[model samples]
Target: MAQYKTPGVYVVEKNAFPNSVVEVATAVPAFIGYTEFSDNKGTSLAQKAWRITSMAEFNAYYGGPPQSKFSINPLPAADPKAPPVTGDFSITDSATKQRTEYELKAEGTSYILYYSMLLFFMNGGGPCYIVSVGHYGDDLDADKISAGIDTLLKEQEPTMVLVPDAVRLSAQDCTTVQTNALMHCGFKMRNRIALLDVYDGYKDRQDPAGDCVGAFREAVGTNFLDFGTAYYPWVNTSIVKEKDIDFTVITNLDVLTDLLKKELSPITDAANPTPAAKVKIDQLNAALAAITSDWTKSQDPATDKQTLNKTLLAVSSLYPQIILAIQKKLNLLPPAAGMAGLYTMVDNTRGVWKAPANISMNGVVSPTVAISNDEQEDLNVTTQGKSINAIRSFIGEGVLVWGARTLDGNSLDWRYVSVRRTMIMIEESLKQACKAYVFEPNTANTWVTIKSMARNFLTSVWKRGGLAGASPDDAFSVFVGLGETMTADDILEGLLKVSILVAVSRPAEFIEITFQQQMQKS
Candidate 1:
C-alpha cells in the first residue's frame, strides 16, 4: 500500500508459494595432495582451493603428474647383466688395471596426483576442487597435508574429502592426517564425507589379513570414525605408462668407457705388435682419455651450458624421471581417488541412495590385494568396527567396489555409506534453503512454509528411489513447530528447530533363497 494521491501503478510480482530446498551437490570432492605444479594463469595456488572440471583443466592449472624415484645400492657381487630395476634404469660396470670393478642402479615412483587424476576423470568425476599442499619438490609431510585439508574448511561446495597421497606419510603421521580429515568432514562440516586409503603396506596382496589393518584401526582410533570410509586394498591401474612416468637411469656408459680403456691398455698390439697397430691403439687410448666432463658441452659459448644440461639430464628433470620409474615398479596405488570418481558417477547416474558398489571400475587392471569372499569376510565385518571395503576383480565381471560399509561398521544406523551420504545430502539441502528464513520472524507461518518446502523436495527424492517407503508418508516425516520441534523458550531465543526423519535405502548386501519340496499334481 502506497500513498494514493501521488503514487502511480506499481506492480510487484512475488513468490506465491513456499521456497523448496535445492539439493546440495553430493559428489564434488576436494582432493588434497602433492602436485607437480599448481598455478592458474600465473598466480600460485599453494594451500588454496582450485576448481577443475576435466583432466585438461587439471593439466592447464596444475602440471601433469610427477615422477617418483628409488635408489638401490647394488647387492654383493653385483651382476653386470642384472636386469634394470625398471625397464629403463641405467647400469654402470667398470674395471681398472688392478681388476677393481663397481656398479650403480636407479628406479621411479609415479606421482599419485597425476595418475590418480587420470583415473578419476576417466571413471566419472566432474568439477571438483584440488588443494596442492606443496609442489613435487616440497616436503610432503603430514603438516603440509593437514594444511591442505584445512584450506577446504572455507569452501562449502565440496561434499566429500580425499587425500590419496596420505599413504606416502609415515604410518603414525598418516593416522594423524586421516584423523584431521575425519574431524573436518564429520564433526566440523557435518555435511561432507571423508574417503581414506589404507597404508601402502596393504598393497602387498599377500597380506589380506596382515597387521596393517589392525595398525590402521589403532592409528585412526574410534572418534568420529563414522564420518569416513576406507577402501582396501589398493588398486593396480593402467593410467600410468612408462612414458608418462619418464624414468631416467644412470646407465653403464661411464663404466663401459672405463672398461674399454682398461682392456685396450693391455692389447697385444700395444705390447709388442706392429707399429701401425700400436699407433692405432695409442690413438684409441687418446680418444678415450678425451672423454672428460666437457665432452658433452657444445662448441658454441651460447649453447654449451644448455646442451650439457640437456645431455646430462639436469638434476630437476632426471630426478623426477628416476622417481617415476620407481613408482612404476609397483603400479598399484591407494584407492581413494578412484573411489571418489566412482562416487561421483553413481551419484550422477543414480541417486545418492544407490550404494556405489558391484560396478566395474574403469582404468583398473585389478586390485592390489585380491580379496576373495573368505578374505573379505574379516575385512567387511570386523569386531573392531573398522570395516575396509574390498575392491575385488571377478572372473568375468572385471574389478568392482564389492563393499559399501563405512568406518562405523558396527553401528546399525550409520552402517552403510549410502545411508550416511543420503542423510548428509538431505541435511545440507535443507540447511541451505533455510537461509531465506534467517532474520524472519520465527513463528508458525515460518514453520509451515519450511515444512511444505521440505516435503515437496523429499517427495521428489522419494519418486527418484532415494527413499525406501511405498509412498511419501511412509518414506519421511518433518516436524517443525512450537510444541513439536521447538518449545516457547526455544522460539523466544530465536532457535527455530526443525526435525526430519527419512528411511534411506540400503544395499542388498546378501540375498537368501528358500525352497521346499512339494507334492506333484498327478
Candidate 2:
C-alpha cells in the first residue's frame, strides 16, 4: 500500500516479492499551482494529490487546439512540365477571427520544399515553417522565414523545418528551445521549407521577452502528453478521406528523380567536357593573334616614316594595305580628315647647318649638332662661324651657344664656348643684354631660370614665324629635361610636380619638353 506524506505526485511500483518496496519520485516536483499524475495506483493519491486537466479548458484559455484531429494529404505529384500551383496558406485565429495570408510560390516547387512541408504535417505538426516566395516584402518576417527554410534544405538529414514569411522569428509567440530545436531539425532535413507562425510572436515589440513567452506557451501546448490542437492541412473531403490517407500518398518517385537528374546532370557534364579544352585553346590563340597584330603595327617603320620622300612613297606603295591597316588599327585619323594631307617633311639639301649640339638663342637645338652635345663643340671654327652667320642672317640678334666638347685636342668644352659666343653677340647687338645666371651646379633655382629662358626663347622664335607657327593654345604638354634618363619613379614624381604647378600657377601656356642631349643615341 502507498501512503502520501506531502501534497505531491509520486510513483509506487508493486514488487513480485510480498515484502519488497519500490518508490519512484516524480521527475519534477508537484507544481504549487496544479499537480498531475499519469496512472491511478492509489485512490487517495488520485483524489487528494493529482487532478485531471481537460483539453477543452486548456484550448479556451490559450490559443485554439493544434492540428491533432486533422491529417495531412500527402504532397501532390509533381508535373515536370505542368505549371506550378500558385496558392499559399492562410492562418486564422478561431477566437479572434484574425487571418493572415502568406504568398506561397512564384517560382516552381523543388522536392526538398515539398517533402519537408509534408513531413512536418505528417509527424504531428505543431508549428510549421512557411515562406512567402512570390513577391518581396518590406517586413523582416518574410526574410527570416526564408532564411530558416534555406538552412533546413542544406542539412544532410533534417528532422524539422522552418517556413518563410515576412514576419520575424522574434515576433512569434513560441518557446526558444522548442522553436530552436524545430529549426535545427528542419535545417538538418531540408532548409528550404519554412513555417509562418514562428514570426507571430515578434509582432510590433522590439524585445524577445514576448516572443520567448509565446514560444513557451506553444511548447507547453505542443507537449506530446498534453492533449492540444495538432497541425493538419486544410484537406478536400471530396477528393480524399481520413482513413483512406494512403490514396494521397504520392508514389511518383519519377518526378523527384527526374528533377534531381536534370539539375545534377548539367553540372557533371560541365565539370568534364570532351571538347572544352580544345575550345579554350582556340580562344587563347585568337587572343594571342590580336595582341601580336597590335604590337607589330605600333612600331612599324614603313607605316610611320619621318619623311614622305620618293623612297618612303615607294615603300608606302609597296605596303599600302599595311599602312591602311595600321591607320585603322591606331585610330590616329579623325573621321572627316582622312590620310591624304598627312605629309612627312624631308630636307634633302645639306645647307650650312649648325652643329646638332649647338643650343640656339631661341632655345632650339641646331639640326646638325642637335644629335649630340660632344659633336656640336667639335665642329671647326669655320663651321661654327657659318652656323652663327646663318642664324643671324635668317633671324636678327639671337644667341648661339657652343654646347659640347670639340673632338679637337683643345681642353675647351662647348658649354663655355657657347656662353662666350652668346655674350659676345649680345654685347655687339644689344647694349643692355646680360647673362642672368649660369647653372654651375644645377640647383632648383638654376633649373627654374633655365626653364624661363627656354620659354622666352621659344616664344620669340614662334613670334618670328608669324601666324604660320603652331598656335599657343592652352594645351597641356610635358617636357622632360636631359639632366638624366628618367626612371618610372622619377617620371611619376615629375608628373606630380607638373600637376601641382599647373594647378597652382594656372599658366596660360603649358608644355612638356625633354632635353635628351646627354642621353645615349638609343
lDDT of 1 by residue, 362-466 (tens): 988877666678888988998998898888898989999999999999999998999999999988898899999999899888888989999999999999999
Q: Least accurate stretch of 10 residues (summed lDDT) in model 2? A: 336-345
- The segments of candidate 1 whose C-alpha lies over 4 angstroms from its true place after superposition are 1-14, 70-110, 201-210, 245-330
lDDT of 2: 0.25
Superposition error at 397 for model 1 (Å): 1.0
Q: What TM-score would each prediction reach against the true structure? A: 0.80, 0.12
Q: Over all chains combined, what TM-score does candidate 2 have?
A: 0.12
By summed lDDT, the worst window of 10 consecutive residues in model 1 runs over: 95-104
